[model samples]
Target chain A: MMTLDQDSIHKHSFNITNLEEIPGKKIKHHYGLVSGSVVRSRNIFADWAAGFKSIIGGELPMYTRLLNTTRNEAIQRMIAQAEFMGANAVTNIRFSTSDVAQGAAEIYVYGTAVFVE
Target chain B: MNGLVTAYLQNHELVVGSALLIVGYIVGTLFQRNHLRSIQEREAFFFKLPAVTMKLKSFVPESHWDQIESARMVVGSVVITPDYFRYFLSGIFDVLGGKVKSYESIVDRARREAILRMKESAPMADIIVNTRLQLDTMQPSIPNMPIRPLAVYAYGTAIRLKKSSFPQSSEEAIRFPDQDIIL
Candidate 1:
């Protein structure tokens, strides 16, 4: 079981933004696009609860949380990759999701790693 | 008396099915009404903060370029499931081969809610640019589930500008739904 330390993972010291350029900073080096992905599935209990909730037409909190955590983990991995490339910050970040299998959801995030000053 | 009992027993499934449908219709309608009302109220509140799909350079004038102080990524996501009543109606419509009106409203509501949430996350930002929305249908492991839950995810770069030149309400920023209905 992989523990999800979302808050701790986000504490990584790297400037991450989804803009063409970081504000008030100049891009000195472009390390190319860095990407990360995660595939996740919910347990039987959560699936059962969501099935019941769907009948009444409402928000499914369990699934929402599952996807949220998955996305955060994927972003963390992307940042780690950028850090490996000796980049100080990442720009133009984007996220995408796809259904890989019957029970699994894949979250993919990508961004350009750059040395900004 | 014996014939009457037999007849009731034979039609018990139909009676129960109709009862369930009636309950689902009433509850689903009430929930949709309340949710739409809440969305309307929040939309009015966030009207001042515009989130557009265009890039920052094109959307904001060149003069405002130097006014931008900082930018950050903001995201909003929601997962909504269709009611049993709608699900049942769509199933029949599937056989008839036509538009599934019930599902359309479900998708619309989720999209609007996701955008509203993105706006709520960045209350201090002057505007959000490069806005994008992703819609996905979650396929659960549960077997025999007729309707899959829909997830709407929205994200954008929220840019903060120097407050001195900030326009409280810009005409260009308010383009959504009915473009002419200005608040």
Candidate 2:
């Protein structure tokens, strides 16, 4: 079981933004760019539904909550990525989802890497 | 003559049976039509979220619009169709309803990716701002089935705020004269 804190892993970029290196600067700090991805399995829910089908059969409301929670988590991850970049601001953020298999769903989060000067 | 009339009546049974078959066929067709209509309604309600959310989000600020000190960007993806299909089949057992809750894994994966990216980028930044989020659909390449695979992508910038910007007044600076002011 991966805890929420465990999900908060970071990846660093070699490119550094030297906003603070300038002489007589009002603020000083090195800026970096970061990006990552989060993935979940579709089989977990499929199995659950299959079990239900074997017993009672019909659509399940449980999927709604599960999907909602996943969506929120994806957003949080994007925010976390921006936070890792050491940026005071993020822009042009976008989200997308894809079906990799019959039961699998993929959610993606991406944004520009920048240093706030 | 009476014996002949009895024979004719016995032979007419096939005709009566044929009429009953025709009537049953008509009733069955009507029931099937109604069932198809209900299925369409159910499908419409089931797949309505992505589009609705996308439209509503447009009116608000994107992830990039905010201003902050430190920020990071990440991308996460998850496949949800399998779970949906499972739920769809389970509709038979009454274990699930029209609401199939399987996309959480995808969203969770995406979030983890984004956070990891952000952490990597802004190890020391205090805060992030100007965040923007967007979503889109990803279709399958196969030509057979009309079922399109859906995908959601989210991206944003990371920022680190300078410490000096937090102070509201110069009084704090004056009180802490011993503090090494970088500005």
Candidate 3:
């Protein structure tokens, strides 16, 4: 078991999967659910670019990049929470995104933290 | 004089509207065609990688379970905005309250692209299982705008099968030093 403090750096590379079980491993302990979320506002410049792009119609790469970054950060935070609980793996991970306001969106990720071997 | 001014304004509006329609049609068609072609090419490239919406055990045999190396979550996301032309067509369809073929194509392309991106993320994985897709629409509260960005997110667990022989004992099994419990 890890005894590291909350502010300490994570020493282990935690595994994350969206499946019920982690392949090639056995779950030794379960620590219940851990989740993380973030709400981000759209950048003004990107919004303007998106407006122009919509006129021509196609993929909005700027918004895509922004959302991807937001989601990855949310997942990282979830992993951090799992690490804080001394868990080395998280299973059955799920993600969701919702628009909270006019230009802001929130991304939430959650999973079951577990110790595996 | 007032009548002449009104007539000129009407003609100007007509010219601008027609010009925008023409531009939107040509550019949107070209963009969609090119995107479709690229999507087809990438799909062919990733034809060997199997991504299923079922559990790995349900499909793979138990005999090969020992050969599994690792599994990790993979995700692919895309945000697409419909071109002016498609949006216009969909608006007309909405008035008719029927099938919006134009919007359907947008969702189809976004879903496929998201899946393709997910596969591209784990090129070396043996297979991806329990795949799921989430779709959302972002309509920024910009006043008087018909723009709605459709976001498609696809995620799954990519499992890699080992190539070497399986370990015979606990001592012989591969161990992750960082994951081991310290007494």
User: lDDT (CA) for every model shown?
Assistant: 0.79, 0.37, 0.79
Off by over 4 Å in 3: A1-12, B1-14, B164-183
DockQ order of candidates, best first? 1, 3, 2
Candidate 2 per-residue C-alpha lDDT over A40-71 given as tens digits, one digit per residue, 9 for 90 to 100: 55445544553332222222234333444565
Worst 10 residues of 2 chain B by lDDT: B48-57
Docking class of 1: acceptable
RMSD to native for every prediction?
A: 6.8, 17.3, 8.4
Q: How do the residues B108-147 of candidate 2 rate in per-residue lDDT, one tens digit apiece?
A: 4333333333323233333333333334433333333332
Question: lDDT, candidate 2, residue B183?
Answer: 19
Task: For model 3, state the Cα shift of residue B135 in Å.
Answer: 0.7
Q: TM-score winner among the candidates?
A: 3
For candidate 3, the chain B TM-score comes to 0.80
Q: Lowest-scoring 10 consecutive residues by lDDT in candidate 2 chain A?
A: A16-25
Better of 2 and 3 by DockQ: 3
User: How do the predictions measure up, each by TM-score?
Assistant: 0.84, 0.30, 0.85
